[model samples]
Target: MTAITLGHLRDALHAGCASAVARVLDAYEVEVDFVDADADELPGMLDNGEIDLLVSAWLPRDAGFVQHGMRLIGLLYRPVYVWASTKPLGPIDTLTSEQVGRFITVSQDAPRLKAALATLPNLAGTPVETCDEEVLYERVSAAAEAGEALVAMIAQPHALFHTDMLHVLEDAQERLGGEMEARMMVRETVAACADSDMLDELSEMTLGNKVMSALDYTIQVEGVDPEDAAEAWQRGRLVPR
Candidate 1:
């Protein structure tokens, strides 16, 4: 292949991992191009040969895509999901639906989160509003500023950034599921790359909590460009010194 095309969601964690991938490939003298894509769009792009690799979280429901010839190369992170609020909500185990105002979540994650909420005793009957991530955050921030107790389901990394603006519902795992494994997915046509000895060198790579926090701090909080953040992460964290 002239170059390996990698696709990922436009999120901080993947942004860091994309950097890591680029640096690894660079060491191998292979060119790489990173493409930002929606979670739903990744399957189509992989199947249609528009991209070779994808770095994103895959829900259990997404196993069908694997049966359709997609391959899981390796996991990059296992992010804990949490329920964040603007006001004190007490323990997650003791919280009830009445305490939650509007449940804001990302549009891409509505289906999964909605299903989880349906089964959660603490969140039963709580209304859910799915919107673009930026809009979701804005709405949550506004609701909190107004003294409305709002809860949002968010990944641990992104939630950490909002600590000053939101209160994380500790022990949310009591009501939610386990950590989501963010991983690299490749088209079967390129599955051989996953098995190549060259893959081993990069396979051990992972975007841990600390690495993600730094990326978010630099890229989102400090306003660094995603590409530059990736480069710094690749060299400073991923590459052996």
Candidate 2:
């Protein structure tokens, strides 16, 4: 078993993939070190050759990390930014200024911030009460766990990884438009490791991490026809493949 120290923000699909991989290849000794892995931090780690691989797996969140000298494995997870509420939802699309009990909180990512604002009603100007990607997930998770006013913003692919804690109030895929993509990066140092048996297992284990799909979900709502995706929305669920 090889040792790899993965650097990614918590609540990312990478963490979820690690959990899945644990079942198959515990001998691989996968250990996840949760760092902020901010835009600046990722490049620094790769520059200094500090980490084995940077497996956030969501391309759009930090494209600067993709500058030359790194290679990417196939798309591992969908880059998602989504939110959910614990209690019953109000008519969000029609939410008036008076109904703006809460505002959409988001990460500093330009695409995520823009997508969240464009989806609902009553939002004007820029994002309010900002947090990074991981914090946004935690806050949204807390809101759903404690049954608070469920309002948040996250990458759509990353959001799918946390199906237990959150649901889609709105999908950024539709909002972000066609150009948005889902992918992950492995530093040049780890590129050699990518083709080994370890990476083959890693790829199989991480195949559909919700963070890299074009539009994939896995909530497993009983009796909700997979074919009738729109009907799933009426029941507060979405198409789960």
Candidate 3:
């Protein structure tokens, strides 16, 4: 079979995911070439057939990027932004004023989450502290160790989710706009090829929230290289042999 070019965003999580996909293709004795690009450029590359497959593209928000002749072939994972706390907060709406005041988030997510919090009358005017990713992780770890009441806005498939310290609060009203799915995309010609059965297998594969979180933790927290981490996971968990 000819070499298939795979593309992924330039992030640790995406890199790990792409590596895992490559391992799967390797098992099938397929030659794989990788293309790592920024999220903004990846879709265009796929549309132009510069890459045969894209490891992922977030739906709805990224839907505009799926130009003509490109198809989203698989649902890889559903990632959601969630409020997690060391305490059992029940749900987002049920948080006490103090808990709301204790809210914290990484800088990149602060604006979006703050806007979401403002939508609720009860949460309006609440202050959400912001910090860098590293500091946020440290804060959560420290809070968990001290058994303090602290709430943090975090996305699933993140390294922090690998721990059991945080209790995820239910967003009963869906205020967070946390509905997003990461899906595999392919050029139309590739999707129509005789070897497209592999795409079918990939489409049916689902690496639930926990596994993806563990994968991220391996790379981010445990200091494992993305490629090595993916190879370890693919061999140990996804396709043990």
Candidate 4:
């Protein structure tokens, strides 16, 4: 069996997506070993051939990570950053003064959200409270239960999108960084040695936003192991090739 090293960021979502790719590689009799590292380090590892493939790369935002010899072999999905609320919100510019005051986001997303807000003159002065992921979920859940309005900047394909009460607000202007494509990147050596058919299949594979969100919910909310969740999805949803 041919062996390959697959690299990914250390997060449940990334782990689950990587597992799905591993499952696909298994069909080609490829043995996959997973290597988890921070976003900053993974690109250099790929450049050094320490890893054969990266399960995903968020383009434009992480475009700086693309090294000289890296090849993007697949686009897994395109997920957009959204402003979600317990109730429907008017357009970004039309947001009520009260809505603008109630904006919140996770600490990790604060910088991006702030940058987006800065582009909207109407919302430049809006206060955005930052909290940890757990606290953000807790506050959103509480607001949903109380039928109160709370606006938040959340990236899609997230477990939070599983909440039935949460609605993505209209952003026709796409001020919130637009769609980010999650793509698979391979080292030049790996692409040269890999089976062409398997590589083509990988390039054609598509897991849209809905399926990605369900994968996230399964691993993050339902507490399923990423490998198990991926296997179930692979068996149930993915077409046999």
lDDT of each: 0.69, 0.48, 0.76, 0.80
- lDDT (tens digit, per residue) of candidate 2 on 58-129: 555467766566666555544444444454455446444443435445545555556556665465642345
Candidate 4 residue lDDT tens string, 22-48: 888999999999999977787678777
Per-residue C-alpha lDDT of model 1 across residues 1-241, encoded as one tens digit per residue: 4478877777765676677677777777777888887667766776777877776545553453453666676777667767788887786667787888778878877876777676667667778888876455567768878999888877666624534777877774545666666666667776665446547755667777666766765665566877787787666752233
Q: In model 1, which regions exceed 4 Å deviation?
A: 11-13, 57-61, 67-69, 119-127, 142-148, 159-164, 170-175, 188-197, 220-222, 235-241
Tens digits of per-residue lDDT for model 3, 1-241: 5678988877667777888777767767788888898766865686678988788877775776677887776777888888888888777876657655477887867787878777666666666688876566678888788877888888777778878888888887776675699888777777777266677688787776666777777876777887788878866762333
TM-score of 2: 0.57
Question: What is the Cα-based TM-score of model 1?
Answer: 0.77
Error of 4 at 167 (Å): 1.0
Estimate the overall C-alpha local distance difference test score of candidate 2: 0.48
Shift of residue 225 alpha carbon in model 3, Å: 2.0
Report the lDDT of model 3 for residue 123: 67
TM-score (C-alpha) between model 4 and the true structure:
0.89
